[model samples]
Target: MTRDEIFKGLNEVFQDVFDDSTLEVEEETTANDVDGWDSFAHITLIVSVEKKFGVKFSMGQVSSMKNVGTMASILLEKLA
Candidate 1:
């Protein structure tokens, strides 16, 4: 999927995981930018994104991502 498409879906996952319907994610958005984005929430977000995209992220990939943009790039690469 294109980056825009991935971001659209990723936004939904983030909002859902955070229980905030109004949450909007930009390329630079990170856990620190969102309230309630603790470690448990991070795992939930990862699992939700994986299920939504039908993609599995390696531990390294998950740990290495710094922001939404990086996650979108990885998703695009895996989907490709």
Candidate 2:
């Protein structure tokens, strides 16, 4: 899938996880950039993302993801 498609899916996951339909995330977005995005929410987001995209992320992959951009890149690689 294209980056636009990835971002579109990510947007939906983020919005659902955060319960804010208006939420929008950029390449640089991180947990600190959003309210209520603690460790718990991060796990939920990861699982939700995997489910949305039909891909799995390793613990290393999860820990290494610095921001939304990194997550998208990883997804791109997995999907590829």
Q: Number of the top candidate by TM-score?
A: 2
- lDDT, candidate 1, 1-80, per-residue tens: 78889989998998899889999999999889999999999999999999999999999999988998999989999999
Number of the predicted model whose lDDT against the real structure is largest? 2
- Candidate 1 at 70: error in angstroms? 0.6
Model 2 C-alpha lDDT per residue in residues 1-80, reported as the tens digit of each score: 99999999999999999999999999999999999999999999999999999999999999999999999999999998
Worst 10 residues of 1 by lDDT: 1-10
Candidate 2, residue 8: the lDDT equals 97
For model 2, give the 10-residue run with minimal summed lDDT: 50-59
Clashing pairs in 1: none
* Full-model lDDT for every candidate: 0.92, 0.97
Cα RMSD of all models vs. native, in order, equals: 0.6, 0.4
- Model 2 scores a TM of 0.98
